[model samples]
Target: MQYAIPAPPPWWSRLLARMSPTEDMPTRGRHPRALVTPHHDEPRPTLAELYRARRLDMVRLALFLVDDLHTAEDVVQDAFAAVCRHHGTSLDGLQDPAAYLHTAVVNAARSVLRRRRTARGHTPPHAGYGPPVDEGLLLAEEHRQVLDALAQLTRRQREVLVLRYWSELTEAQIAKTLGLSRGTVKSTASRALDALEKKLKVVR
Candidate 1:
């Protein structure tokens, strides 16, 4: 007698759909505004405007890296501070402030992780707060499960996956952010997705 294999759950498909880059990503018109370079004629946003727009997104990105909302906020704060120190509040003479800030946030998150590793007496923050809550994005049960699976991945894998899917960064941008080659970023993301899918399978 022949038997059919069990299909993956609906949520698995949803998860992949959410994680995959949009088809329009290859088109210049559909690129993320933050990633796109502004034309000379276009008005540049002030530092405050950029902060208001990107702060929450940056915090979300950091939360995935550090695994704590409070610490993530701190990391983002430090990133802004570093940018201001180097570029000033006016953001004068910087051609790509958003890109610069993206690199700063990634570096800041790395620093936090490094410090946590070195501090012998470091106590992880309490888990009472639970998975991160965002006004615009609510975490469902399956998505929370995915986050749990993500936590099991290596640091490099986690960074590659998060930056690729969550931040919607391209391979080149992820490579520049993590100081890895584009090929490395591509391979790591592929491996990371395979690992993540396997982990999710066990849960499903």
Candidate 2:
């Protein structure tokens, strides 16, 4: 039986509508003063618009960081909520809203990892379950090995590798996002790749 595709969320439609371009008319008849004065009351994009625009990509990023879809969604939600609380309707005021959202999601994912670590420490040794076989099947064996090894690295190393390779961010962007020096980001990423290779028993 054929199934209908799910419609895009309401916020997604609104975001698309907001992004639609309008034709510019001749301003020859308008007063010059009107152009010089910034409209303080102009309707700017809000946290909701940003969220609708970026939520899926942000959640995917969090998933790479945290390795759990539910946790990733929670992380993204918390990130957006934090942005809302901080910026409200003035999201456009931020110099780089996308960068801010990326930083917020990373921070939230780190918090989730910290909490999971603490909980794991308190739990019985046999309480943990193995990852699902379907998840393993989703990637090629080499890719799976890489991810397994990636998970075994230090949190900083994993962050560096994931942000660099998975997110395809430049070293400078990673450094800015993670609040690290450019040299530090380069060294950390190199070390992370080395450690991952060692874990996967790769010659390179």
Candidate 3:
């Protein structure tokens, strides 16, 4: 008797955590019963390949938010493993899996922040230092200045900016992902932009 095991709702499971959803539908491979096998099934090759494909990008993004490559890698790897554990099969159902993954990465980064806080009571990194880049060409002076401005913002402002402008997520999506009220998200984003604008004007 091969009965299927139903997983929890995708939203509540925290499988992808805070990473943005994927741009394309992730393939979980074909199972005799369904396109995606249930949670208990061994991880399919498609999911593994999918993780491999996205791992590097996720690491860079995580590094931008968390400021440590090693920790970022762990976050990215955890996200992949989670997708395999909880949503591996259902990832194919997602419209924008890349965005989903983005949310997950962001969440995992937050968890990392919480853990770090508990351990060392350190504050999050400043975003106003420069636009985030992953192993790219050296940033120009202006670029460094931009990041410096971003770093000066509160963590809320920086997160809203990254999710809204950098990730292109909607206010509704950002609010839901961050477990905040939609109005709060909008206000935070507005304030963040306002602060950033003031700094940019001064820089110019």
Against the unseen true structure, what C-alpha lDDT does each candidate score? 0.72, 0.65, 0.59
Error of 1 at 138 (Å): 5.1
Model 3: residues with Cα > 4 Å off, grouped in runs:
1-46, 89-96, 122-145, 198-204
Per-model TM-score on C-alpha atoms: 0.73, 0.69, 0.55
Shift of residue 71 alpha carbon in model 3, Å:
3.5
| Candidate 1 lDDT over residue span 49-154, tens digit each | 6687677677777877877767889999999999889878877677877777778988898899788766734555552334445612534566678777887899
lDDT of 3 by residue, 34-121 (tens): 2222243444335655564556656756665665556778898777766666666546554445556677788788888688767554
Best TM-score goes to which candidate? Answer: 1
| Model 1 TM | 0.73
Which segments of model 1 are wrong by more than 4 Å? 1-37, 120-138
CA error at residue 30 for candidate 2, angstroms: 38
lDDT of 2 by residue, 85-189 (tens): 887756766656766778899999999989999999999999963555554433344444555676788888788766775455677878888999777777777
Q: Number of the top candidate by lDDT?
A: 1
The lowest-lDDT stretch of 10 consecutive residues in candidate 3 is 27-36
Clashing pairs in 1: none
